[model samples]
Target: MTADTDATDAGAAATDVTEPGATPTATDTTVTPATSAHPGPDAAAPAARSGRRRRVGGGLAVVPLLAFVALAFGIPALAMLDGAFTVKDPVTGASSYGVANVTASVQGAYLTALIGSVKLSAFSAAIGVVCGLLLAQAVVTSRSRVLREAVLTASGVLANFGGVPLAFAFVATLGNSGFLTRRLDLTDKGWSLYSFSGLTLAYLYFLIPLMVLTITPALEGLRTQWREAARNNGATNAQYWRHVALPVLAPSLLGGFVLLFGSAFAAYATAAAMVGSSIPLVTLQIADALAGNVLVGQENVALALSLDMVLVAGLVMAVYLPLQRRSARWLA
Candidate 1:
């Protein structure tokens, strides 16, 4: 009886074990392979493909802008380059490529005009940066929104107010026998409205407003916390500005100067109307060259001058862009 019981118990235990090639019961659990948490090469391929497609689409969208730039700026630049290098003889109508025009553009009257333009631009930009920075600070610190808006609106209007009308306005107010000139007796003081000093004053009229506009956003970007932190660190107002504010603002100030310099350098109409050919300026020189007022067949020289201006502008941009990038990193 004991042997029979042992054999039956062993047979029961053997029946409970699952064997190979046997069907699994309803309650039997099967083991599965573990999955990784991170995405594999195959999983990331679609995302990479999607990013590539977006880049391609963005490139396609920029095609029209590229075409416009080619037509508007590139073609003109190429023509100017060709004209600048190509010399045409007046006697025989013969044409040759050389750097004569470029060379001539940097000598004699051209050289004087270039120097004058640089001086005027530098002076005006320096003054404008100072005055504009002060005015912007005032506007930014004001409690009245109406006053701020009014100044900003006036600045916008005045900044765009240039050319013939601006020249006329200045002449009417400051010219010989004008209302202000007569009342103030400015002529007796040897103040000539058509002189270099007068031109600089006129430039300031617009440059100040432009500076205000350029620097206002930067002024507003100054954080209250920065001031509070400086005060907490036992810094006085002057020390705070010297150590912190000026350093942070230096880039923006430089950028504004570049902007003003470029504006003053390229200005033609106001100077032409106010001072005529009395004051030497690159823009006036260019006009004289193009209109054949100074000499016949000097258009190539004008193109060369244009090239010089473009190079100067490019240099200014090179400086400005880096400063702008640095300013953005801090302010943003």
Candidate 2:
């Protein structure tokens, strides 16, 4: 056989063969892409796969998040909303869905609880925001290193130290049998740290620190140039605040009050511990209902209580709806 040796020929594959006297021919096709030095399909595969994996990974985050909310928050919320208008049949233990299930007595209790909660929360938030603003201003404008550090350190501690322990601390400091009460000999007119008024004071203790922390950032956002410009234009401190600082800080302050109100409204542990069965907070009421009273079935009452909570929270949110629509980003 006459052996043809041409590298360009389709059948001439190997110029250097391992076997002696054997030449392997290429197939009847040209291989163009497989040996491309720049980028073959395989080399690009990893990057393309990585791109796809990133998209899938990012999309997967939402799935677990939504699923978590659905399983835990959504399901329970729906159940609560349903319970608001549904009642258990005393005889068969079947739920009877009707608007009438939100009876006059339940409605009264809800309204009473809501009014009390809002009053306490509003008073607490107002006091908190005012004190926090002053404290933050003092800290931010302080020239003393020691005082600044002390303020920051105390703020951090008190901001986190709320609820039951906070309640008990007040009880020790200001209650009828408190240290100060004995020292001052005001046993007849001692501070009541367990009553509604006292609870408002306790709420202020933590909430003020929270407001200070929240609004400090906003205060720091104020430009030194603006204040200097105002001063250069011969504006008084009050005028500077009225014209510039107030305008900028008002939204944040209002938003903080909204947040603080929501917090205080839902607080249970402090309120419950301070008064136990003596005071009837909505959260405490919900807990009581969950215990399954012989008169009011557990599920039925828990549902109603949940509904009551949603309604009160909804009302508080409604109060902030205008603000929500306006400076939502700032508020958030």
Candidate 3:
């Protein structure tokens, strides 16, 4: 009996001990819980919900800006559209919906004003683009931080400094019987402060600075590595500008031109104060129609002219937006 009990104990000890190159028995094997590599559908639901919530929050943040635009711009644009199409008779006090106001706006003196405004804006913007680009390049290349800050500060101030005050300042300095006019004998030299050319000069005062502000960031976006690469590739300064710099900057330059064009196009107070109706401009025509300075009952025509201006602005934006998008790739 003792021998049999000893033999049973030995067999149990042998079962518990695992031997090398031996298969494990059911009693010796441990069962571990199986785990999946990928998360189940239940686990993924919360993540999707969180992502949706973040998107909702982002959309909510833009609501205010959309509301402001709808209130400020949409309402005015709709009003202008309504007024542009509405025609009224002064004597009969009768109203009709037609394109008469729009037709009248684009004919005769109004046409002249539109053409003149376009020419003036194009000329001033072209000049401003060139001059401002050069000035911004100079500022960017300068060693003095103080000079750069001074120039930028002055530009910011001067860009916003327009309207009646700007007109008065220019008149005081460049008008007939004015300080510079008399001293320099500008009138003898066929220089009149109240002429189209003078108006262009006045526009440049603000436009150049605006161009400076607009193009400076683009100029700064030019990477030094590009210059180095160009130099290493046997490019001269002129070649570098023509091949490397100008190409990259073209979109930005065009965008700046568009901005300057719009600014010069819509300007009113300065032109009204300085040149009156001497230089035909759409803005002046609009003012004359609204105030009946030229003819009474032309209010509808004024709205039509404003609509025309808005259309022109839309065209400018159409051109500018594409250029801006293309430039953003390189600059960003």
Highest TM-score: give the candidate number: 3
Q: Rate the local accuracy (lDDT) of all candidates.
A: 0.94, 0.75, 0.94
lDDT of 3: 0.94
Ranking by TM-score: 3, 1, 2
Which has the better TM-score: candidate 1, or candidate 2? Answer: 1
How much is the lDDT of residue 262 in candidate 1?
94
The deviation in Å at residue 272 for candidate 2 is: 1.4
Native-to-model Cα distance after best TM-score fit, residue 73 in candidate 2, in Å: 1.7
lDDT for position 258 in model 2 = 78
Candidate 2 lDDT, tens digit per residue, 63-97?
98899989999988887778767866779978777
Worst 10 residues of 2 by lDDT: 1-10
Q: Candidate 2 at 313: error in angstroms?
A: 2.7
Better of 2 and 3 by TM-score: 3
* Candidate 2 to truth, TM: 0.74
Encode model 3's per-residue lDDT on 56-110: one tens digit a residue: 9999999999999999999999999999999887789888899999999899999
lDDT of 3 at 98: 95
Q: Which ten contiguous residues of candidate 3 have the minimum total lDDT? A: 319-328
